[model samples]
Target: MCRWLAYSGTPILLEELLYKPEHSLIDQSMHARLGVGTTNGDGFGVGWYTPDGPAEPTLFRGTGPAWGDDNLRELAHSVRSGLFLAHIRASTGTPVQQTNCHPFRHGRWLWLHNGRIRGFPTLKRTLMLAVDPELFPEIGGSTDSELMFYLALTFGLERDPVGAVERMVGWVEEVGHRYGIDHAMQMTVATSDGQRLWSFRYSSERNSRSLYCSTAVETLRTMYPENPVLQRVTEGTRIVVSEPLGGLVGAWQPIAESSYELVTPGMDVVGRFNPQSAQAGLPVPATVGANGG
Candidate 1:
């Protein structure tokens, strides 16, 4: 439905990932091999943190194909960030407006998603009503992606990201069930707090979107000992994307179905993620724990 990339570590121009890679995000916008569509021309956005800038990341967005935006190309070449997220949107039955573009933000957090709710229009009101009234006004678009973000916030994302997400999804399924819809969700979502990056891939039917996290830079370097590109990116750097940017062998690892990942300053962590249906009364929204390598 869409494509996105999240990056951390080694301050470098945005083009390093947006345009320079063999199958860069820009290239993906035109020829996405894994996305449902070959072109994601509806809109695009990017948010990034600068060492000396404000605590909140800077954002740039437009209601046109990323590959055709002159301003985006110029900015990508000029701005440098160690942490950033970029998205190319393919409308999932939503109007293609600048406001609907992804890499959505609130406070210092940025978010993007790559799938759709199976029957969002049918369940929009019911699902949205569940969002905290205080957080409701912050929603700027009609896409299920944005609603899902606020849902997570309503469930306490700032303090418990994984748990909040589980709760959010659980609540969605709860609503969908009330309407007799079987597969109400499909998502591969990425979010960042200007520090750590978190990503999740899951679906109601157990078959979710495609997502991958970069192999550890140290391991890639060891595997491609003669490749200078491997040496250039630091060991702490990480990238989570909707698909592999290129055909670099051993450079990407598939995230498991119904799973989530965390990229912190110290290490990368992965953990199980399953729907915690309210009907089942499971302890899903509880503090979801993880293990790091």
Candidate 2:
């Protein structure tokens, strides 16, 4: 129900990915081809790391369509970073308030999600109770996506990101089954701790949301031998997004279902997801219609 992009590598002007591409994130906010909806106008947010600040990221978010936000346009043109996360929201049932927008932050970590819990309200209480009390106060929104972040943090996300997120998804599915809801979770999440970037694509039913990663810098260099921009980036640069930003067909590859990917300073690693045993014990929340109203 949303679109997002995570980038890591040589620092480049934000507009190169957010606005310059043919199918840029801004363009997707108005014409998303792969999202559940065609438009994700509810809100938008961006989180990026800079050399001058605390290792923690700086965030800019708004409760309006990204395409109409002049501030976002200006900032995207001027700011640059080696790592960044950007999201355009299509609220499932939450209010379109600024706090509810994504690229949510807590200390040095930043997170964003592109899917919803099938039955959030019914599960909210139980899920909220499960978050580590210390991290609970850092949650600033009512979206199930944001709640999911805190749950991962509760399970030690800061130390073992892949494991914690898998645990969170496992708990969500377990709760769904307890309520007789067949498929209660769908998500493609991206998180960064100002260094490595972690991303996942999963759903209980096996047909997860769309997630893609850019070609390896070496591969891109070989494919576009004459493109200077392609050559300017370092071999370690990588990008993960809900959809490809440009028409460079060979530049993106879809992430497999039920898998997680890790982008570090030197390499990109991908692996299968395994749920935690404890997660299977949580109760599923009751279901409700799509009246997100």
The TM-score that candidate 1 achieves is: 0.93
- Alpha-carbon shift of residue 186 in model 2 (angstroms): 0.3
- lDDT, candidate 2, 20-76, per-residue tens: 889999999999999888999999999999877776799999999999999999999
Q: Candidate 1 — which pairs collide?
A: none
In candidate 2, where is summed lDDT lowest over 10 consecutive residues? 284-293
Residue 202's lDDT in candidate 1 = 96
lDDT for model 2, on a 0 to 1 scale?
0.87
Residue 189 in model 2: shift from native, Å? 0.4
lDDT tens readout by residue for model 1, 1-293: 99999999888899989999999999999999987889999999999998899989888989989999999999999999999999999998999997799988989998899999888888887777667777788898889999999888877789888888888899788777777888888999999899899999999999887899999988888888999777787888999999999999988999999999999886888999976643333232232222100
What's the lDDT for all of these models?
A: 0.87, 0.87
User: Which stretch of 10 consecutive residues in model 1 shows the poorest summed lDDT?
Assistant: 284-293
